[model samples]
Target chain A: MKTINLAESTVRDLNQALHDQAIECTEREWEVLEPKGQHNIACGLDQNISVDIKGPTGYFCAGMNKKAHITIHGNAGQGVAENMMSGSVRVKGNASQAAGATAHGGLLVIEGDAGARCGISMKGVDIVVKGSVGHMSCFMGQAGSLVVCGDAGDALGDSLYETHIYVKGEVKSLGADCIAKEMRDEHIEELSELLNRAGVDEDVTAFKRYGTARQLYNFKVDNTAAY
Target chain B: MCGIVGLYLKNKALENQLGELFEPMLIAMTDRGPDSAGFAIYGDEVPEGSIKLTLRHANEDYDWAGLAGKLKHELNVGVEWFNNSKVAIFKIATSDGIAEAFITENAPDVLILSAGQSIEILKEVGLPVNIAKTFNLKGMKGSHIIGHTRMATESAVTMEGSHPFSTGMDLCLVHNGSLSNHNRLRQELQREGIVFETENDSEVAAGYLTWRLKQGDTLNEALTNSLKDLDGFFTFTVGTRDGFAVMRDPIACKPAVMAETDDYVAMASEYQALTTLPGIENAKIWEPEAATIYVWERSSETGVK
Candidate 1:
């Protein structure tokens, strides 16, 4: 196992060294020895790399991520996989706001908690969080699926369009146009797929579903009843 | 628009106001509002009876002690003692008008804002470090800090109108959105002899808030009043020497996040701006409650866990 430790180096030095070493690590690299508030540590990776960040990160740790598989052992700051187009980021600890905001495509999994606006304005990103999200989570979401294993805060899925939200726990309040929806067969299948991808071991059948009721999708006089 | 950030170290509550917690975070975001930057930092270690002030008007001759006395008088209180700076620091908790009277006399466009217990305001057109350092910014020993970077959207980017604008001696305000009813509020407040120097709608906000604070109303009370009285999109953070306050319009138009750790708290205009703060042990983040005012006090030595 090749272990490049960042014992005394800042997140900046470690990232630079990783990039300079040209080590296209295939397996999970042993450790990020010492990381103090490092930001954008594993951004924009195209290789099939597996990384294990030893400690917490500052912000946007794997933003714009693609192809590589990454994991962080400790808590993470805001915008973890923001604008990511593909691949995966597994956060073992709680995450800050906008965890997977504006990702066109990708898989983001959080084993712990996430802050407000998780997956906000998400464009085709698949995100799974184990804990609660603060208010206005998934605001202005265009597409994709956001799964929450725990409770969701106020205004969940506010101003959403097309994006599907699956929450296993109780919801504090629904956003402007968001309403409860029946979990159908296709939804169960999709939830299972996302759960498996995020390494969530729970059975998909246990979770309830919530989504945009399509009431406010387009403005019209007749639609006013549902809106 | 300004890059304003602050964090109040409550034992357990949402993050906000007092200026100390936001230091470098807003500094990084200084590029967004580089015209000028000033901060109010509060700390547990600062001695009593000493005042901290930020001085930025280079063209004028000023009297620090005399200004401090005026601060004591107009606030309608007694001054025990004060510490002088290009920016002055006051350790005495006189009436609110004391600080305002001083700022009024000096006319350097001062901001009587603070994180939890310190007020510092500097007005100039430049980078963050340029103005912040002149007031010994990085050297501050505080629990939180709030600052502003000016983009000069509406009003002339003068030293007077720069954020953290002050109305009450202990209160300063920084804003991120336009006030739709500024003209109306301006007219109303001006009719009451509340003088304004610039066209920035935030000034109206500051004026509105300061007037309310002077009426013996709490920060939260004034902020709550703003929801109905003030129109348009706004996300504002206000700081008092001992407490921090925040308010967002009903629309949640502009962005501001409350992110905190056990020891520190942070608020910023964007997620990218908080990319440099320390301690994120499961850092839970939240948005300001729309049209709601949240106020918090710094964790004091009273040992109220």
Candidate 2:
């Protein structure tokens, strides 16, 4: 195992060391000590390595990842796993706003509650939150799956498209072009897989599904008032 | 964007180290707001019928003792003062209004930063580190502190435009977002006899709270009313005599994270400002919900437990 203490080294040093693995690929496991809530930790990594951050992180932790798996043991700041291509990011504690924002493909699991705008504008990513999510979760999401094992805040899944949203607890308010949909067998299967991948043990049947109503897919003159 | 950091020590044992712990928190947020920095510390209370005033002059070599001597001669009240950087802290055994009137008439160039029993505000247009060092912030002992670093979105980069604005006695506010209707609100508040020092939107917010408190509204109630009346994004941390309160606008675009332990309750715009705190690993950390008011006061029985 490789260890980098942030108290001694800067974030640039840590990212450079992690990025070096893309060419040589010698170290498969890494640990970061004293994360100290700094920004841009382990960002832009393309290697298939696992990095464990021992403390809370600042903005854009594990941002723009390709094939690396990152785990934050404490809370995460804004935009964790933003614009990721592939791989996984796990936040063991609560996350600030815009978790998994604009990520193309990856799996992001948040064990604690998340602030506003979780999974915003996501494309082809899968997110599972063990606790509640704040307002405007999954806003303008194009393609992804957001599974919440707990409650959801106001305006859930606003202007969504082709994204599956599963919430086990209460939803404060559904956003425009978003409504509760009937949970079919395929949705149940998909949610069960996401929950299992996120290591959340919950009954799949207890969840309700929400998605775009397909009315806003094309701008109709009748829908002008809603806009 | 601006950054706000506040620390309220619940344990009296940590009172002496308040500035030592809070100085780094403000310094860590330099990137967020590097235009200006300021803070309002609540400590060193004066006796009954006495108020402490924090005054600032552009000239660092201004004679603060001369001003105090003149104030004593005019107000007929014993006045004692000390200087910190370009600011001066004065303890006068008189009413806040009378002392302020005397200063405004006699020392026209002096800017009254704050006037209260326990609050002292110091602000300057500079980086947080330089401001901290110049003000000797590391040695300041206090029970609670509220600070701000400004990037100057709504107004100019002058010291008057900096945050931690005080519009009332022992009450101040630090904000992290812009208000859209401040110009209109300022006109309305001015008609109600609320005096504003600058065109900064944050000063208007502080004035609004002062107006509300004058209307017999509690801090929590005033904040709830602000959520409805004030437009635009805001994450405000307000410091009062007995306690402090935090509130964010309904949209909550501006971020605010709070952590509390047995010893203290700390808040900042991001987690980075709180990383240097002791026992933070075990603190109960959470993001304050949108449009919610969170208040912690130094109670008579158990203090800020």
Candidate 3:
């Protein structure tokens, strides 16, 4: 196990050390101490290692991760694990806005509530929140799946495309062209697999699925006045 | 991108260390706003019928004593003042408009940053660390404080453009986002007798709140009404005589994090600012919801009201 103290070394040094693992794979497990809510800790790691961040973090913590399993012991600031390509990131506490934003791939499991824009513009990421999510959770989501065990705020999946959304609790209001869809066997199986991956113990059959209505996918002259 | 930080002490024992606890929170936001920095601290309440005014002059050698002497000789009012650098605090026993008018008429160059029973605002165009040091922020004691570091998006980086804009008695505001409809709103407020000091959009926000408060609205009421009337993205931390309040716009593009401990309630634009506070690890921290008003007051039985 490799230990890095943020109090003693800079975030650059920490990230550089983590990035170095891709070149030469010696140490596989890393522990970060005293994160002190600094931005960009353990970000942009391409190696397949496990990192445990021991404290709360500021913006963009573990952002743009390609292949790394990172776990935050405390709350994460804005855009945590944003734009990740692969691997998994787990936040033990609440996450601020835009968690897993625009990530192409990965599994993000937030044990606590997530702030607004939880998985905005995500391409292929699978996010499961054990607690509620704030408004505008998955705006313009192109792909991926968002699972909310608790209540969801307004505009769950606005202007979405090919993204699957499952919620066990109340959704405040759906966005334009977003509506509740049938929960089929395949969806339940998919949601079950996602919940199992996120380590969440919940009844998959009790969830409702929502997706794009496919109304605004193409421009229509009849809707030109609304535009 | 501006930075806003506020500390409201719930425990009376922590009052004396308000500045000491708040300085690091302000300095931590240096990267967010490096053009200018300012803070409004609420403490040292004057007796009834008296007000404290924080005055700033362009020249550091501006004789504050002479100004006080002139006011004492002309207005026949007792004036006690404390001067530091180009800023001075004048405590005078007078009515609402007399002292402020006299100072403006007598000394046009001297800008009255704040006038209230308990509020003193210090702000300048510089780094947050240097501004905090210049104001001796670490040694001063207060019950509550609201600070701002500005990266000046909507206006020039002038002292007048700095935040913690005071528009009402014992009430000041520091903002982290830009106001879009300030020009039209400023015209409407000016027509309603609300005074504006600068072209900055944040001052317009302060003026709008002052107008609402003048209409017999409480601090929380005024902030709630601002959501409907004010346009643009903003996360504001307001300082009153009793305590402080935090409000974010409905859009809430700008960030705001709040933490509440047994000792104090701290708020900043980012979580990093609260990291330096004592017992922060155990504090109940959360992001304040959009278009919501969170107020903490000493007079209230419960800290949040």
Model 3 error, position A204 (Å) = 1.4
Give the local distance difference test score of model 1. 0.71
- Kindly report the root-mean-square deviation of model 3 from the true structure over all alpha carbons: 1.5
lDDT of 2 at A8: 99
Model 2: residue B277 alpha-carbon error in angstroms? 1.2
TM-score of each: 0.73, 0.96, 0.98
| CA deviation > 4 Å runs, candidate 1 | A1-41, A54-60, A73-78, A121-123, A139-143, A158-161, A203-205, A215-227, B7-29, B41-57, B60-120, B138-145, B177-180, B231-235, B248-292, B298-305
In CAPRI terms, where does candidate 1 land? incorrect
Per-model DockQ against the true two-chain complex: 0.14, 0.85, 0.89
Q: Pick the candidate with the highest TM-score.
A: 3
Which residue pairs in candidate 3 have backbone atoms (N, alpha carbon, C) closer than 3 angstroms, thus clashing? none
lDDT per residue for candidate 2 within A1-227, as digits (tens), equals: 99999999999999999999999999999999999999999999999999999999999999999899999999999999999899999999999999999999989999999899999999989999999999999999899899998899999999988889999999999988999999999998998889888889999999999999987787688768996
Each candidate's interface RMSD, rounded to one decimal? Answer: 4.4, 0.7, 0.6
User: How does chain B of model 2 score on TM-score?
Assistant: 0.96
Better of 1 and 2 by lDDT: 2
Q: In terms of DockQ, which candidate is strongest?
A: 3
Native contacts kept, each candidate = 0.00, 0.87, 0.87
